[model samples]
Target: MDIQRYLQHIHFAGTPKANLHTLEQLHRCHMLAVPFENLSIIYHQGIHLTPAALFSKIVEHNRGGFCYELNRIFALLLQQIGFQVSFISGEIRARDGTFGPPFDHMALVVTLDQPYLVDVGFGDAFLTPLKIITSEQQPQASGTFHLEHDGDYYSLERRNGDRCSHAKTLYRFTLQPRQPEEFNGMCHYHCTSPQSHFTQKLVCSRPTENGRITLSESKLIITQDRQRKESTLHSHEERLAVLRHYFNIELNVQAA
Candidate 1:
């Protein structure tokens, strides 16, 4: 991959080094610039796991993607910039209080002064990488997150604030190194299976400087300073306009 071109695509201007500051900046820039979207699945455009395909779709075509596409490409960018990055498997926590299958999600572990959990594809997640320390709350603009360890697995949890009664567990992962191709099955499942959420709805979202904007189904929800305002999109033209205006995506597909 062309590292400079990729950096420009993500709007990362400075010279990147493999330090914590650079990592943080890159992560934040990526979260702001590249949205977390599943438009391809809705449009019947197949998801390809190759690096060329990812870079072409995200950078060349100016589009966004879900976890597998986003995290894999971001990992390649980090590796090219001299960071020690590894792919790790995560099982997402379902609403029924059960964890999904292993490799349900892909995340990164970047080793610098210490190992830090880095993820840009989990929509509305921590903007900067969280240090891999269990029980220590790592506060971010989005929310407060912490890692919980149980034997070989580590669970990432988030809470709105100290007043929140329960901490939501986003997903659980292990330190075991993974290969990008190993996630292909789950990626394909997400793109094709009826049980996967990607196949169920059209969601495109990204974080802004003060808040986040999301287009789910026919609703456009913008949250600023913790206040949310939602608008219902009535027509395909309106939905397309919202996608272009809010997420900077110009999709040619009809509503799914």
Candidate 2:
């Protein structure tokens, strides 16, 4: 992979190092720059898990992807920058209070001074890495997060409010290192399955300096400092224009 090209793709100009500062900067840069999008699924396209294809689609074409595509390439970028990274699997917590299947999501267990959970794939997530080795509430630009260990599995949760009673489980994962290939089946499932949310709508979102902006199908929502503005696009042209304006994505609906 071309490390310099990937760095440019994320618009990251900071020094790359195997330290917290670099990790945090890279994490925030990637999250804010590359959106968490599922446009390919909307176009009935298969999501490729290969590193070469990921780099081509994300870095070359200047597009974003879901968990597998984003985390895989991000892990490689970290490794190239001399940070120890392990590809790990995460099971998303469903609304019904049940965890999804194994490898439902892809993330990284980056071994820095202490292990940290790093993910640019999960939409509407924290802007910085979370300390997975601790139970202490870690404050972030987005919200406070913490890890809860239940035997072999670790649950990563974010606080919905200032108190602990509102902790919401984002996803559950184990520290076991996994190969990128292990997620192939579930990745395919996410893109094609009728039950999958990615297949249900067109979504592209990214974090802003104050809050975030998300576009789902024709609805556009922009939030800044807890205040939000919502709008709807009545035409395809308007929707595409919103994508280009906010996420820097130019989509040819027919070509996608």
Top model number, TM-score: 1
Q: How accurate locally is residue 175 in candidate 1, as Cα lDDT from 0 to 100?
A: 97
In order, what is each prediction's RMSD in angstroms? 1.0, 1.5
TM-score versus the correct structure, for each prediction? 0.98, 0.96
Model 1 lDDT per residue over 1-256, tens place: 9989989988998899989999999999999999999989998999987899999999999899999999999999999989999999999999998999988999999999999999999998999999999857888888899898999999999988783648999999999999988998999899999999999999999999999999999999999998999999999999999988887788888666
**Tens-digit lDDT track of model 2 for 1-256:** 9988888888889668789999998999999889999998998666887789999889998899999999999998999889999989899999999999999999998987788899999998888998886558887868888888999999988885686468899999999999888999999899889999888889999999999999988899999998999998898888889988998787877633
Backbone clashes under 3 angstroms, per model: 0, 0
- Where model 2 places Cα greater than 4 Å from the true spot, the runs are none
Return the TM-score for candidate 2, rounded to 2 decimals: 0.96
Candidate 1: segments with Cα more than 4 A from true spot? none
Q: Could you tell me which residue pairs clash in candidate 1?
A: none
- In order, what lDDT does every prediction score? 0.92, 0.89
